[model samples]
Target: MNPTKNSKRKTGRVFDPDATFLSNHPRLSIMILLFLYTVFLIVPSLLYTLFVTPIFYATHLYLLHIINFFSVAILWSIIVPLVLGLPNKREFIEYAKDIKIARIKPVLRSIGLGIITAFITLTCMLFANFLSSLLTGGQVQFVPQLLIHPGTTNIYTSLLLGIWEEVAFRGVMLVLILKIRSKRFSIISNGLLFGAFHSVNILSGFLGAILFGVEYNREHFIPVLFQIVYTAMLGTFLAYMFVKTKMLLPCIIAHYLIDALNTLVILNTEQLNWAYFCFMTFVGIGFLPMIINIPLVRSFSFWFPEPDDEIIPFFDTFLVRKQRLKQYKSDIRSA
Candidate 1:
């Protein structure tokens, strides 16, 4: 009996010498994946908030944002793929497909579809912000800090943020979860995790208050909580877009535009209270985008074929159910 064949039959998965040990253990791999991703993403900002910004003094905020951009880009774009043993072109392509970033056939059509989605989402976002401002009796004012700051930090940071986040959450996390669960489960799980990810801001605020004497109070908490909830819903939409488009670019572009616009303007109001927060969280971030983008994404389907939801790749083997493994071993023994 061939040992490798016997092993494959028992496990129901072809053995890959290069696959990481953790990849075979789904639960542990997931915990490690989230831990590492979160550490890399939040640590830089946290450190800056706690220590580096205070010491450096000038160019502090700019440096912090730049550091964040580089840290996120390097981790997701370069390090993760290399760690996954995707050195070969074909292997990398397969990895990309699994994550829904593959250059699907008819590349031009895909690019056009992505751009259209971005345009519609951005327009809707602006309208939502405007309506939110009007209803709250607030004025959307230019963010004076970003506007007065030197260089194009806002632009580049927004662009990189969009790329890094969509690639990390929608491209990678959502895809991995989808492999192991149903689409609804994967999408909702991703959204909740994404929402929880924003909770780090509370920590950052607390650190700032402790170290630099910045005020951290209930008012601050409210905004952070609102951000957590809003981003959660936004994450769900972004994941849906990835599913509908079968490409990651649309999500990235939409996220970038949203971030860039946010950096430009903020809702300013004399009546800054809980009522404002509640309205923004539920109506502005929640209901507004849903009303806007559903038709736009669907209308474009006729222009080109929607990519099938099926995502078969070697990673699927790593995520096999325990019952399947048991069945495979029992069949092999009987045979």
Candidate 2:
């Protein structure tokens, strides 16, 4: 049965049946999005383990990183749009707007916010490390890594990841959820899914360890679990940022900065213990952002968009008044 027959609205933009169907069946859309994303990540990782790593080994391992860069770009930047049925520029532009990457003003504001978040996250991390050192009687060591010090490949990878991940999680997935649910639900679900998505990395890591004949212990497993938890928290925070700011740029910037900074800063953990790791991962990087987001979520002054608010294409317009739109559609059906 054609579901799009009665789904028309006077929004005066392109009417895509696929988009309509996805909108109508939010669970199906989310599943498709997650399925596509997971397949790309897992397949490539397996390919790398089975093919690339054996050949590259150690010296040429940088090749895998380069491949990863192109793979992510292709998946999120190219394949996703095609899957969403955006076959042309105009349709793609509208999709971009839905993802909160269209307008310049909000993007600029996003950049500022991204910088602030990065600063706050880094400060918390450093402070956590210092406290860890103090309690454990370990000397705090600060080392600044340069872009070209070891190689520029990792730097590029970090930046590429920052952009593409936001595009996928916040831009695509979060927007999809927002279309069908409350803002709070969207942010929380997006964050949780985003964190769960990273669980694929644990599998990849295990495969790598197996390939190398290395014994995987709880030390490795536990850290990966911690990573998943912290990333979930971080994802939720980023989701909140995307919802509040209505732009993807800030999240991209923040994601990139945090990854890049973590890579560049080599903290000394010789005298530190699990307490340090737990505090830094759970409290500093995780809960801190969530704590910061609480106040913004509570503020209801400009919470939902009015009917007359300048429509920024799909996401914001449809999301802010989703209930009202449902009623409007119901009224139309009755009429």
Clashes of each: 0, 0
Clashing pairs in 2: none
lDDT of each: 0.65, 0.68
Rate residue 248 of model 2 by lDDT. 75
lDDT of 1 by residue, 1-335 (tens): 78886643333122345555544443455566567777886788777766654557455567777788888777776766666532212244456665666544455666666566556555655555577677777777667477436344366667666888888788777765664566767777888888888897787778668877777878788789888987888787778777767777677767776666554656676654565566556655554564456566666656555554333444345435545888999999999
TM-score, predicted candidate 1 vs. hidden true structure: 0.73
**Where is model 2 more than 4 Å wrong at Cα?**
1-20, 52-55, 86-90, 146-154, 270-272, 293-335
lDDT of 2 by residue, 1-335 (tens): 55695464223233345565555555676678777776776676567767654546466656666666677778776666655542222255456666767643533454666787887787777777777777776656645555433344245668666988898889887876666567877789888988888777777668768778888777677777777888888899889877776767778888888877764444566542677778777656888756865464336315334322233455556555766988999999999
| TM-score per candidate, chains pooled | 0.73, 0.76
Could you say which candidate leads in TM-score?
A: 2
Weakest ten-residue segment in model 1 by summed lDDT = 7-16
